[model samples]
Structure formats: C-alpha cells, structure tokens
Target: MMWRKVKKFFSALGPGLVTGASDDDPSGIATYSQAGAKYGLATLWTVIITFPLMAAIQEMCARIGLVTSVGLTTTLKKHYPRPVLYLMILFSVPAIILNIGADIASMGAVANLLFPSVAPIWFSLVFTALLLIVIIFLPYAKFVNVLKYLCLVLLLYIIVPFLTRPDWSEVLHHLFLPRITADREQIGMLVAILGTTISPYLFFWQTNMVAEDVKVIRKQVMVNKRMIIVAGNEADPRAREKRVMGLLLQKMGLDVNLGMLLSNVIMFFIILTAGTALFPKGVRNIETVEQAAQALRPVAGDLSYLLFAAGVIGTGALAIPVLGGCLSYIVSEALGWKGDLDKKFDRAKGFYGVIIVALLLGLLINYLGISPVQALLYTALLYGVTSPVIIAIILHLANNKKIMGEHTNSRWSNFLGGITLILMTLSAVLLVYFQFFNRS
Candidate 1:
C-alpha cells in the first residue's frame, strides 16, 4: 500500500517539475553564472530569499488555473479590463518570442561547442525544427518525461561546484550575510538574475500545467461526482464514503499552492549552487552559456566541463519548447482560440501555428548574425523591465476573491508576495537607472 501510494504521488507530479527545470534556461544559467563569478557568495542570499517567493507566486498561478479551468491569459481577459489585458499580452507575447529566439541561439551555441564544424546559424535552425517536430508530433506524456530527464543536466552544476572546493566558511557566511555594493553594474546584474529567475514565462506555464493536471484529476473524479449526485437513489452510506475519498483525492491533486512551493525550492537551489561556486573567484564576465561552462573546466576539471556542457544542452533544449509554447499559449488564449497541448493540431490550428511560427522566427533571428550573448543580455534587460508589471498582476489576480474563490491567498502569502513585488519593482528601477542614468 505504501509503495502504491508513492507510485501515485510520482504519477501526479508534472507541471511543477517542468516549470522548475525550465527556470534553468540558457539565459538563466548565464545570469546565475555571472552572479557567482562576479559577486561570489555576497549575492547568494538572494537565492535563499527568492525560494519562498518564487514558490508562492508559482503556486498562486497554479491555483488560479485549477480553480478557474482557464489559462492565465484567459483569466486576465475575463477579470481584468480589456485594455489592461491587451497591454499585458502585447508586452508578454513578443518578449517570450524573443527569449525563445535567444534560447535557439544559446542551444546552437552548445551544439557548436560539441561540434565546432557546424555553422551556429544552421545548427540553430535545425534544432528549432527538431523541437517543433517533437512537440507537435510526440505524445504529451513522452514529451514531459524527456524534459524531466533533461533536468538531470543541472546536477552538473552541483558536481562542478563541489570540485571547485569552495571555502565552506565563506560560502556559509555569504549565504547568511547580505552584501550590498554601490557599483551600478553589480546592482544591474543582481536585478537581471532576479528578473530572469522569477520570470513571466514560468507563471503562464505553471498555470496551464495546473489546468492540465485538473483535467486529469477531473476525469478520475467524474465517476465519484456522479455517484454523489445519484446518492439519494441508492441510499448507500458505504458508497457515499467511497465518493468522498475520490473527491478528496481530486482536491489534493488540484492544490496549486503546493505546486508553486515545490518549484520555487528547486529554483532556489539552482541559484544557490551557482552563487557558491562561481561568484567568489572574481570570475565576473560571462556572455554565453559556453563561457559559463568553459569557466568551470579550469576549476572543476574536464569532468565538470563535460557536465556543465551537458547541463547547458539539456536545459537549453527543454527551455526552447517552453519558450515557444508559452508564447503560443498567450497568443491563442488572447485571441480566444482553443489552446492546449492535449488537443490535436486540427482542433487547435492557430495554437500550434503560433508555436511553429515562434520557433521559425527564433531560428531566423539566430541566423541573422545576432550574437547569442548579446541577445541574452537584451532579453534579460527586457524581462527585468517587464517583470514588475506581471508580478503585480499575478498578485492582484491571486488575491481577488472572485477568481480564487475560497482558495484566496492567506495573509502571509499576500504579505510575502507584496514584498517580492516591491523588491522586484525596486530592482527593475535600479537596473534601468544604472543602465540609462547612473552610467551616464
């Protein structure tokens, strides 16, 4: 019975893991690596600080999806004023596509590291096409499983960090003590790391994945609901008890809050590993995933380099689909089209088309001679600026009684979420000020 229960729990896990792993995208890796190499453990506290907040936000997104049976875009359309929804979608859609474009370039960069003979542009195009084919043609279960395994690539960071033989005392001290630098560049990088880690794409993806989880649970509970509806006719107490158990299981499955916490914890560690290993050595400059990975080889040895490279390839591949898919979700949801991965292409033509188009456009962008490193920097800055708005919206949506019903955020959740919002807003402001004002 215990084994069976564990099996059931494992079976239920999906969206949370996917969203968490996706957080380690190439851009995120670059940001975190830069953070570690430059600041060392001084900024390590941010990872710990962000864990709960990231989890809370993601959980709220999942909850919104489970309760409403709608995607984030659909909920925004219904609850928020039209103009607000339109503005949010407008900012969100292109940003996601551009990020996907950056990911394609990043992934191609990884492939080039492995096979230097291949042109990066062609490599990016071929990889984009392959991603499209897999996502469009493969079954959802298979696709998710592949992504899950891809997450193992992140373990490379763990091994590499350990091999670096970081000073444990300093690592601990930095993890606990908050260090502030007046240097504008450092502050900007800090904000960039925060922005990329707790991003908008994860929000949309988490919510939709929750909705999908609900559909699965609903199918499993429909019979129980029917039994309860017909309870009076049978008048069987035992049957009613069984119905209640089914309902309970369904309720557990729909717990979006729990999902959010789980994903956030994972995010915290990924940042933590990077902060401890990369930041303290004065290895500040990083522009590409390859640079980040290559930096590890010197300290962590060839094995570490291999692992870092593998992690980049794995995370980059996993994120490429999501980066495109999330944009597709927003476009389809905004336009009021049937949008779901479970649906066949015929049923959701526009949805799939958007995914394909985003992937192709990303491919083209990579081929246009735009350096992946430059694209990542721009993407990070863009996300940093736009993140506060999305976070504010998420907080409002989560707290809204009309949307969340009885599952509205607890006072603690709201308070924490508020704090995160403020911090993110401040970071965005600092980043812009540094970029445009301080440097001047």
Candidate 2:
C-alpha cells in the first residue's frame, strides 16, 4: 500500500515538476552560484521569500489553463485588446530567446570544462542539434518523461554542498534572516535571483502545458471535460464533471507546490555550495557555470567539480526545451497557428518553425563575443524588469470571475499574488533606477 501510494504520488506530478526543475536551468544556476560566490550566505534569504510567491503564481497559471483549456497567450488574445497582447509578445520573445541562448552556451562551456579537447562552440552546435531533433521528433509523452527524469540530475547540487560540509549554523542564520542592502551590486544580484525564479516564460509554459494535459484527458476520459450550462432554469449535468475537475485541480496544486519547493531547495543548495566552497577562498565573481565548476576543484574537491559540471549539462538539456516550447506557444497562440508537442512537425509547421528559428538564433549568440554567463545574468535582469507586468496580468486573469467561474483566486491566493506583484514591481523599478540613474 505504501509503495502504491508512493508510485501514485510520483505519477501525479507532471508539468509543475518539469517547470520547477527547469527553473533552475544552467542560467539560473549561474545566477545562484554568482550570488553565493559574491556575497556568501547574504543572498540565501531570497530563496525563502520566493517559494510561496512562486507556488502561488504558478498555481494560478495552472488553474487558468485547466479552466480555460487554453494557453495564457490564447486567453490574452481572445479577451484583451490587441496592443496588450502584442506588447507582451514583443518584450517576451527577445528575453526568452536570449535565455535559451545563454543555457545552450553554458552547457557547452561546462562540457568543455569536463573534457578539454573539443572547443565550447562545437559542443554548443552538437547540443543544439540534439535538442532540435528531440523537440521536433519525439512524441509529447516521451518528451515529458525525459524531462521528468532529467530533474533527478539536480540532486547533484543538493549533494555537492554537503560534500563541502558547510557551517549549518551560518546557513540557517542566513536562510531565516533577510540580508538586503542598497548597494548596487547586491541589489542587482537580488533582482537576478528574483527574475530567474519568478520568470514570465514559466507563466506561459505552465498554463499551456496544463491546457495540453486537459486536452489529453479529454481524449482519454471524455466525460470529465464538461462545464456549466447557461440556461437559468435547466438542471446542471456537470456534477460529476465538476468533481473530476476539482480532483484535477487538487492534483495540480500538489504538483506545483512540490515542484516549486524542489526548485527552491536545489537553488538554496547551489548557493550554499558556492558560498561554502568558493566564497571564503576569495572566489568572488562567477561569470559562467564553467567558472563555478572550475573554482570548486581546489576548494571542494574533484567530486564537487564533476557533479557541478554534470548538473549544468543535465539542466541545460532540461531547460532549453521549455524555453523553446514557451516561445513557440506564445507565437503560435497569438498568431492563431496550430501547435502542440504531440503533433507532427508537418501539422504544426509554424509552431515548430518558431522553435527551430529561436534555437538557431540562440546558437548564433555564442559567436558574438559575449560571455554566456554574463548574458545569462542580463537575461535574468530583463526577465526581472518585464515580469511584473506579466505577473499583474496573471493576477488579473486569475481573479476574473468570467474566466475562472467559481474557481477564482481564493483569499490567500489573492494575498500572496498581490504581494508578489508589489514586490516584483518594486524590484523592477529599483533595478531600472540603479541601471540608468544611479550608475555613479
């Protein structure tokens, strides 16, 4: 009975787990590693603060998908004015592509660190090709399973910190006590961490994947998809359907909370590994995943370095598809093109084409004399600046009774969502001011 329950629990986890694991992609790892390397445990509190907010917002996104049976972009295009939808696409596409580029480059750099013979560019090309083939050719179910298993790769991060045996007292102190400041560098790092954690692309991906899952369920179990009737006098036929939907949403909440919790826990461990392993040794700045791994060799031993490097590749593989798929979903939905991972490429040409083009552009970014880690940081900054707008939109969508029916945001959801909005908005404003005005 216990084994069956454990198996069922794992089986129920889906998009949320993938999304959460992808949240700590190589780019995110670089951000967290940079945080720890630069400020030691000072930045640890951000993880603590972001957990509930991330879980709350992601649950909203998942609920939107389940209720509407559509992606966020589709809902936006259908309900909002054209400019609002277009403006979001305009800001989102560039940042997401850059994110894909950064992850691809980081994977290649780390691969080179593991094996010094081949150059990073060659590794980047090979990985790009591999990802392209995997995304385009694999069936959606297989692809999702692949991602779910890849999430296990992140366990390496949790293990690495312990290998160095960090000071538990200091770690707990920093985890609980918030250490923030007005310093430009520290604030910038904080914003990067926030941006990496509460990303906008994630909102679209989560909603769309849930919508897709509903589509799958509708096919596999047809009776569960019906909603309410409009005639005032008519008796409702959706009582059983409503129960099924309720069960689905409950499962989704469990999936999302667990996923986000895992994401942040891995995030915390990465920071701890970097802080304990590199910070005290005066390794202050980490610009790449490779640099972070390399710095671990002398201080944290070879096993730590090897695990860090391996985790980079695993997370890059896990995350790039999500980045590519999200961009495709946004474009396809906005343009009214057919798109789904389960569909053959010929059937979803425009959707798959957008993904292809994005990956190619991302691959091209590596040759432009830009540092992959630096680009990752800047991508996080861009995400930080633009996410508040997206978060506000998500909040509006979640609360709109017309959209959600009786499933609108609960009081606690509203409270957490509101706080997320305010906090992200302030962080964006501060980042902009610091970047443009306080450059002295």
Which portions of model 2 show Cα errors greater than 4 Å? 1-9, 223-236
lDDT tens readout by residue for model 1, 368-425: 7767666765666676777788888888988888887667788887988898899888
Question: What digit string (tens of lDDT, one per residue) describes model 2 on residues 1-440?
Answer: 98787556666787999999999998889889999999999999888899999999999999999999999999998888999898888888988889999899989989999889999999999999999999999999888878888898999999999999999999999999987787888987887788789999999999999999989887766564343321123355566577678778888999999999999999999999999999999999787888999999999999999999999999999999999999999999998998789899999999999999999999999988767765665676677777888898899999999999999999999999999999899888877787779888
Candidate 1 Cα outliers beyond 4 Å, as residue runs: 1-10, 223-282
Q: How good is model 2 by TM-score? A: 0.94
Among these predictions, the greatest lDDT belongs to 2
lDDT of 1: 0.73
The 0-to-1 C-alpha lDDT of every candidate, in the order given, reads: 0.73, 0.90
**Model 2 local distance difference test score:** 0.90
> For each candidate, what TM-score against the reference?
0.87, 0.94
